[model samples]
Target: MSTAVHDHPHGHDDHAHHPSGLARYLTTTNHKDIGTMYLWFSFAMFLTGGVMALVIRAELFQPGLQVVNPDFFNQMTTLHGLIMVFGAIMPAFVGFANWQIPMMIGAPDMAFPRLNNWSFWLLPPAALLLVTSLFVPGGAAAAGWTLYPPLTVQMGMGMDLAIFAVHILGMSSILGSINIITTLLNMRAPGMTLMKMPLFCWTWLITAYLLLAAMPVLAGAVTMILTDRHFGTHFFNPAGGGDPVLFQHIFWFFGHPEVYIIAIPAFGVISQVIPAFSRKPLFGYTSMVYATASIAILSFIVWAHHMYTTGMPVQAQLFFMYATSLIAVPTGVKVFNWVATMWKGSLSFETPMLFAIGFLFLFTIGGFTGLVLAIVPIDIQLHDTYYVVAHFHYVMVAGALFAAFAGVYFWIPKWTGRMYDETLGKWHFWLSFIFFNMAFFVQHFLGLAGMPRRIPDYALQFADFNMVSSIGAFGFGLAQLLFLYVVVKCIRSGEQAPAKAWEGADTLEWTHLPSPAPYHSFETPPMVK
Candidate 1:
């Protein structure tokens, strides 16, 4: 509504009156502070989940349940999936949105800043409930992260803890989503219309809506389980005249879109990194926007693809199979655009670009395997095997996690006002890339050999690959410590970075801001044109 840019002649130091120490984090509504907290919290959860994964890999190392009992092993698998998906990946992206979105769009802060604070604070207690559940009487929910009904109904008090945790996490997601959507829609600077905004902003706008729509479905699914367990309701009980298949329908309805909720933002990160490093404007910005929208829409109809082995009518199976495969079309458009952006441009291989490239190569492999799994016949074969496990890790680990690493490496200089050690950054990327492949690639073979997932012990024929995978898992986990070190070292004492750290970058945050962006950025709205 206002096309005027206010000037602050007194400069940054004159307006500094924010609180200090723990009180600042507890009681402030600053987007940057909340974002920093989100990033650190996500990293903590990532490490916690990584430890659980190592336990699973170690137990499966030689296939005898040597390290833990079968029951405990199941709990590790369940908790690892839940923490990584909800705690690690989702919050990490939200952190990036908090830090980057307002600045990118030239807004002073999120539209609902106090709600942003509340959204972030909600995560820790929910995460604590999840971690504490593992120690409660009878251990955490072990029916797997999908939390299917009948198995869920039979579990102990820990299951109740997990249900409550899900409710809290869902609330966090929904609130965060609403904040993001409101800020993007209402807070863009004058002259910066939606089409001219950066691709990252566009992706988050879509992702936030996806969260709003999908999280409620998850909340509903879990609530039914809570009622079935204690209130004698039969939402998923056959003897109570309900259908178990109904639970799968509802859970996967949320579950499948949940995959993109984690990934679409990753796509946004990669979209930004590729162009910044390539010294090019994005090749097809409009098409990229439309393709992302198409993928989100398609995510809803393809949920049943995860349930192919659960027995559906032939016609139902055919409809889902075709819908699932059709997703690749828009996904391919995105991939083609990334490669085209890099086509003969003056590309520099910075740490961020390295991770972005890794994301492209590995995420494509994941997508291809996904395409293979989309065929009803093939999915029926691979549904519960390690092949399914390998497929998603490629998508989630390489797709979301790798893109997150790219975003951090790309933007950390801005956040900290110092350059990271390139040597160590490269080391972190290469080690993670190598070990990641080592850990998951072999699982495809193990699955083809009929090695089942979620089991502590495997047949003797699966021994060698499992051991190799275990070694790789340990390596991948250790690589992340290098990442943590690099980030902290940068903050403490790395070289100073220029105001615009990357030469090829063109966004407003890069073009208009100083390094270590001021405590309050864009206190005066930036003119977009």
Candidate 2:
């Protein structure tokens, strides 16, 4: 596979022959170049969305609206959801795919590199459409990120912009899925079979298929809303022979799978980061694979659990309750396998491992809350309340965002050829962990007290808890700046990283390639066995 290691550290000067500056990014089809752009773009969106969240939190801090008005608050919530889900979290994981997939599988680049370039280029314009909607006469789509029925129909051109953004984003996602599927199936090196692929690759492969199946459904849902808003169709408007429940059905059909589309990649990241720090092979690898596929398959049937309060028949409620409950089994399997991998092994609390263990702890909490909400009666009590909000943040922040943190810390050495500040890295993790809990943990109380979500103001009874949550929210948001510093410091002036930075990193990227991989990676595909 490799005769000797080359010292290709830090600056990728091997390709002075390659284009530089803005030209390198705009027109280049190289996987790593495109990957870097995707990451930077995602971080920019994360900050953009984080600001919206802070605005929402600030308003909720007091009984009367102190920061933004009711309408503005809705805009913040709506834009925050759209930006985080579509613009921040999803793109971060796709950045990982663009960077890691080719290297892990010993392919020179993605099978469809030009398509990769085009897919990433689609995001910024979509983001522009979303953010710019705020300045429009109607002040963005206030019907919430779900773009739910009658409100969307009544909204102004802002809703149309949001709809068009969704369309562009969906097209980007569809193209990405096709590229990933083809690359995985048709481009593995001589001996790297499907079963032998890294768990991250396996997870992404499944996620790609989920994207392929679900994106069009979301596109259709939003398109119908667009027609209702503009062309006077009644797909979801009751006055014109339509049912609003139809929107929920179609949205959740795509939406529930979207949860796992974010999660399963996280599952893959934890799978890798945990075992490497534990100095053990991942426990029950085969079963982990099957479990992941099971989760993806189960995601389809459980969409109705989210709709139970909308007056589905009791039988349908029971069916969804049971179906949603069944997902916990495979999820529990993945968690069990991760914990088992760390049992009695040489564990180290590197920043990556700290983030992984945090993911294990909090994501489990989210999963438990998810189970609690799966019960029909319990969900009826908590619907549209802060409890649902708390549960979702735990899942998305811990499940996907924490795992993304771990992956960045784990692989930044490879990507940048320099070591991150260990001290600052730990600080980043601890600050994030403590403040995140402080911000969100109290929201559970607010929800149980019957405070509804998506509101600008709350009753005085929810006051003290909301204040604490806001303070914590501010702290948590500030902690991310430390993360940014750690990464930038590593890249600009940190110590040089060796080829194998982690003692137990066993993937082809670590074992067969040098640090800060060469521009033309795998000029000759490394044989697996």
Candidate 3:
């Protein structure tokens, strides 16, 4: 690899001057600025969702209703799921894509800069609609985040608000996906082939396509809910000759693919971080790409697994069960590849690597539980139980959130040109890792004991684990402040970082760019060979 810097024939001076302060963020089309906004906004939503989780935990701290009423409890559960999935996890990954994708592939910027800005700006308003709906005539949507028809139709104006929020979120996701797909397909450097691109870029390309395919199904489902509520439509009203189960079909069609949308990108982050820390080229790179694509394709077929209890025919149930369980094969390949990448290599326990290892360990637990749920009889027994809740948080929090933290720690040095306090970073990781398990792991036991989810209160037998889970939830919530502190402290006054922050980091961003990548990176695309 060469260590030379090349200037483009058309340079930064030809580009318009970027505005400073508020104007910079509000009017900028710069990918870095837009990426920063996406990150901050997602963190805000993470805190909001975390608070809702605490409220639910607080009410469930003891047997019998103690704090919120059942309706409000339902609202808390619904909003917590919606906000965390749409606002926090999805956008955080998009933020990473915006900041790293262009640099990784040696592109000047996202394919559509103004559309990128519009996509980010759409989020806050949608989030506001969701939060403010709690104050509306009947409170926020109490139907689970799935927004099933009958319960959704029974809700007040808040359901409408939630419906609209989903629409806006879908639009933003579609637009963002378009930008990512276009950028990856059209803007690589002179000689960088698709196979030569970093794993992170490859993951985002697949995720962007998943978003495009899935968001419309969600949008259509919500639109039907809206019509059933206001217009004289019976799309889901059984009394009006519509089947409520149809809503499940549509929602899961979008919902199941959504699981991979969140997890695959996290897989990408771990794929990058593990090899860098272990000082090895990624094991089975071609196979990893094929495995990721296979997972995405399989996602569409396996969605009916979520509907096993909705009473499909035995043959359909068996097919779904088998298809759902088969996802493990590719997912297993990814996990094995990461472990093999680190096997007997010169490994370091940097904060990033720690979180990658945590993602691997915890996400596998989530995956195994998913396999258990895929068995039709087992799902019939455990559907809508705390077991389901426990399973997803393991995947979402440990899988996506842990990987996001790893990406942040791994790349923040390059983003900010400063080293974060290693001591604080490690502390943040351990506290989060321990408390995250503490909070959700026990729910698996509670579910096996037959504790139902989405209820305000539970029977006495489930009391102890719920208490432990609540305490863990609070600890997990508070530990995030330490992450905030580390990010801020690094931005403000940490030691300066070098061009290639990690010795094993070999991508274009690390090898070809300076610390704190220039505002106009790849003003001229670098030669890849």
Best candidate according to TM-score: 1
- The TM-scores of all predictions, comma-separated, are 0.99, 0.97, 0.98
How would you encode candidate 1's per-residue C-alpha lDDT over 292-350 as one tens digit per residue?
Answer: 99999999999999999888999999999999999999999999999999999999999
lDDT of 3 by residue, 161-276 (tens): 99999999999999999999999998888788899989999999999999999999999999998889899899999899999999999999999999999999999999999999
Clashing pairs in 3: none
User: Model 2 over residues 1-529: C-alpha lDDT tens digits?
Assistant: 4422345433223553578889988998998988888899999999999999999998888899678889989989999999999999999999999999999998878999999999999999999999999999989999889888888888888899999999999999999999999999977877898999999999999999999999999999999998887787999988899999999999999999999999999999999899999999999999999999999999999999888889999999999999999999999999999999999989999999999999999999999999999999999999999999999999999789999999999999999988999999999999999999999999999999999999898888999999999999999999999999998999999899999999988999899888888777875677788
Relative to the true structure, candidate 3 has a C-alpha RMSD (angstroms) of: 2.2
Q: Which of the two candidates, 1 or 3, achieves a greater lDDT against the reference?
A: 1
Model 2, poorest ten-residue lDDT window?
A: 3-12
Cα RMSD, each candidate:
1.2, 2.8, 2.2
lDDT by candidate, in order shown: 0.94, 0.93, 0.93
